[model samples]
Target: MAQQDRAVQTRERIVTGAATAFYRVGYADASIATIAETAGVTKGALYFHFSSKEEIARAVIDEQHRRVFESAAEILQATASPAETMMLMCADLAEWLVSDVVVRAGIRLTTGGAIFDPPTRAPYDDWLATFEDLVGRAVAAGELRQGTDPARLAHFIIPSFTGVQLLSDVLTNMDDLKVRVGELWDVLLAAFAEPTRLDELLALRFRIFGPAS
Candidate 1:
């Protein structure tokens, strides 16, 4: 039992260390020896827990996906008006990308050609599929526009966000992101709102994103 606990600790240490290294150096530059040094373990210990640097990179990406989904689900499940919910969800998504080191690195690696190997793309694609499903659910529930093609929208939005995040990576200040997203969300909702809501749409935009005037 004691041995098992120590083993678990060692594995967790490796995971955390690898995540940090990947964030700092990127997947291409990160190495198992560096990870082992960061984790305060030998190369053999890293191999004992993870077979290769690629495996460790996959683990890092998977962990980022898990954390992202968990946070997104929590926000989606909360009780709120559809507009409010959508805003919160987008804001939370941005915050997660900007705040989480592993998530930021994983996003860059998956989208920026850091790890283009077939094995890596599969897991990355799976993550995008999961994201699309969540967006589809939000659309079905009327939180987003029903006419919105979730997969297509996701392809566009995800990459746009990836670009924005990469830009945000250099900016540090989040106010610009928040303001720009607020404007864009207003535009998206205007295009997608049901016809009847058109009468009050401008007001709704004001409520959701603040006064245009």
Candidate 2:
């Protein structure tokens, strides 16, 4: 168990280090030698775990999706209300986008061309499909309004996160990010929540998303 744990930690360290290195420097510019060095392991050690740079990149992205999907599932399982569940999902995604180094790297990779690959897109497609199914469940539960399309809701929410990711790459100010995200959530809540629930949702915006100020 100890050796297994160590191996897992080492692999994770390599993934995280490679992700940060790739994000800071373009993947085209990053080399396995450098990644190994950044990860504090020898090139042979890296090779023992991952045969090539492409494999490492894919592993990093896969781990990122694993974390995101796991978090989403946990959030969904914890809540019975669809509205609250979706809001929490968005919040969790946004929080990771804003904070996690690995996820930020994955976002960059997605926009940079890695997502065009079949293996790269597979996990993402599965995750999105599952999330959409959750939205469908919400609709069936009557937590969402009539005619609410699960795929459409997933489409809208996913793009919002990616849009923020693109903006984060260019916009250096975190304060502006908070305001922009708050406004975006306001628009989303307005569109999805019942009219009678708007005021409560307005309060929920601050509660879930935090203060924009």
Candidate 3:
């Protein structure tokens, strides 16, 4: 049991180290030697856990999805209003993008898949489905204006958020990600929110981005 636990810990350490390396240098520049050194494990150990850099990258992406989906599920369970839950989920994602190396690296790799062969689109698809579900719920509750299509909204939102975060990373190293996301919500809410719910939805911007500064 102890040996299995130790092995799991080692694997986790390697994944974390690889994530940090990938976040700092990007997938093309990140090397296995650097990942192994950062992980404080020999190359042999790293190879034992993951056969290749792509494998490690895949693991990091999987971890990122797991963390995000778990958090979203928890928030959905606790929040009755689908709109509020979606807002909170966006805030949480922005926070993670800024603070978590695994998420940052995973996102970078997922979107910038030119470096990987046979790139995976599963992450984007999964997020789109999640967003569609939330928007459908919100529309059903009349939180959004009539004629809002959940699928179309989700398709727009995921790419929009991705662009905002990528630009934030390039321009400010993500220092402005939270504010940008709040701004995104501001525009989106104006377009889709029911007139009666506009004020409350707009106020959610403050909860996410904090006071003007």
Candidate 4:
């Protein structure tokens, strides 16, 4: 049992170290030696855990998704309002982007054209499905404007966020990611919230995330 636990720990360290290396130098430039040094593990141990850099990149992406999906699920359970759930969910994601190296590396590895296969699909499709479900629920609950199409809203929102984060990464290196996300919420509320529910959504946003700036 102890040996198994240690192995788990080692693998975790390697993933985290790989994330740091990937984030700093990107996937292509990050060599096995760099990853091993960053991870504080020997080459043999790294090779034991992962046969190749590509496999390690996939593991990092998987870990990143697991973290994000878990947090989103928690927020969804805590919030009764679908709109509120979606809002807090996104805020949590922005926070992850700012604070978590694994997430940042995963975003770069998956979106930066490092991996060119199936796992390369951004956290995007998953979020789109989730957003669409919540939007549908919000429309049903009268949280959004009448006649709003959930699929349309979901598609627009995901891309809008993608653009916001991409630009934030390019310009500020995401120094202002949370701020950009907050601003994005403002625009979303203006466009999506029902007239009668707009003020409520705005208030909820303030309570949950403080303020855009």
Candidate 5:
């Protein structure tokens, strides 16, 4: 049992180290030797856990997706109001992207498709489905304006958020991501939310991002 636990810890260390390297240098520049050195493990140990850099990158992506879904589940359990849930979900992800190395690296790799052979779109598809479900629920609840297309809204929101984060990363190293995302919600809620629910929906922005400076 102890040996298994140690092995798991070693594997986690390697993944974390790889994520940090990838986040700093991107997939094309990150090397296995550097990752192994950062993890404080020999190359042989890294190989024992992960056969290749792509495998490590894939693991990081999978872990990031898992965290996102976990956040979604928590939001769903806490609130039935889809607008509130969506805002909160975005807030949670923005926070993660700023603070979590794995999330930063995974998203960078997912969007930098030239780095990956076969170019997986699973992360985007999963997020799109999640946003679609949330928007559909909002429309059903009359929180969204009439004639709002859930699919269209989902597609827009996902890419917009992605762009916002990418810009934040480049401009401020994500120090301002939470603020940028709040600004995005300000625009989106004003446009899409029902007039009666606009104030309530907009209020969630403050809760997630806190009072703006």
Candidate 6:
């Protein structure tokens, strides 16, 4: 049992170390030596867990998607309002990207042309489905204006958010991501929220983003 646990820990260390290297440098630039050093493992240990940088990159991407869904599920369980839940989820993810090296690596890998056989779109489609369900709930609750197409709105929001996140990463290393998310929500709420509840939703936004927002 102890040996198994140690093996698991070593594998995780390699994955995490590789993630930090990938986050700091593009996949093309990150080297096995850097990953081994960052992970505090020998090259042999890393090779035991992963055959190549490509395998490690794929692991990081899988971990990122897992974390994204896990965090959203936790928030959904805690928040009754779907609109508020969506905002909170985005805020959490923005902060996560800032602090979590593994998550950051995954985002970079996806954007930087790292190819995986199963493809990355499958996870994105699941995410879109989650967002669409939330939007559908918000529409049903009358938080959004009538005639709002939940599917279309969800599809739009996800890609718009991807652009916002990617641009923030490029321009600010995601230092401004939380604020950018607030901005995105501001426009989204203005466009789709029911007139009677727009003010209330905006107030929620301010509370979430702070009065400075």
lDDT of 4 by residue, 120-209 (tens): 665778999999999999999999987888889999998888788888988999988878888888998988889999999999888766
- Native RMSD of candidate 1 (Å): 4.1
- When 5 and 6 are scored with TM-score, the better candidate is 5
lDDT of 4: 0.88
TM-score for each predicted model, relative to the true structure: 0.73, 0.85, 0.95, 0.93, 0.94, 0.93
Residue 208, candidate 4: Cα error in Å is 3.3
Worst lDDT 10-window in candidate 1: 204-213
Candidate 1: Cα lDDT at 108: 61
Which runs in model 5 stand beyond 4 Å of their true positions?
211-213
lDDT string, candidate 3, 1-213, tens digits: 698999999999999999999987878788999999988999999999999999999999899888988988898899458888888888899988988888888888887878777887888898899999999999989888878999999999999998999999999999988888888887888899999988887776687677543
lDDT of 1 at 183: 64
Against the reference, the lDDT scores of all candidates come to 0.67, 0.75, 0.88, 0.88, 0.87, 0.85
Per-residue alpha-carbon lDDT of model 1 for 143-209, expressed as tens digits? 6666778788667655665566566566754445655566666666666655555445446445654
Error of 3 at 136 (Å): 1.0
Per-residue lDDT tens digits of candidate 2, residues 86-149?
7677677667767888886776776666434653566557656866886787667655556888
Tens digits of lDDT, candidate 5, 34-113: 89988889999999999889999999888887887798788889945888888888988997897888888888878777
* TM-score-superior candidate, 3 or 6: 3
List where candidate 3 sits over 4 angstroms from the true fold.
211-213
Which of the numbered candidates is closest to the native, going by highest TM-score?
A: 3
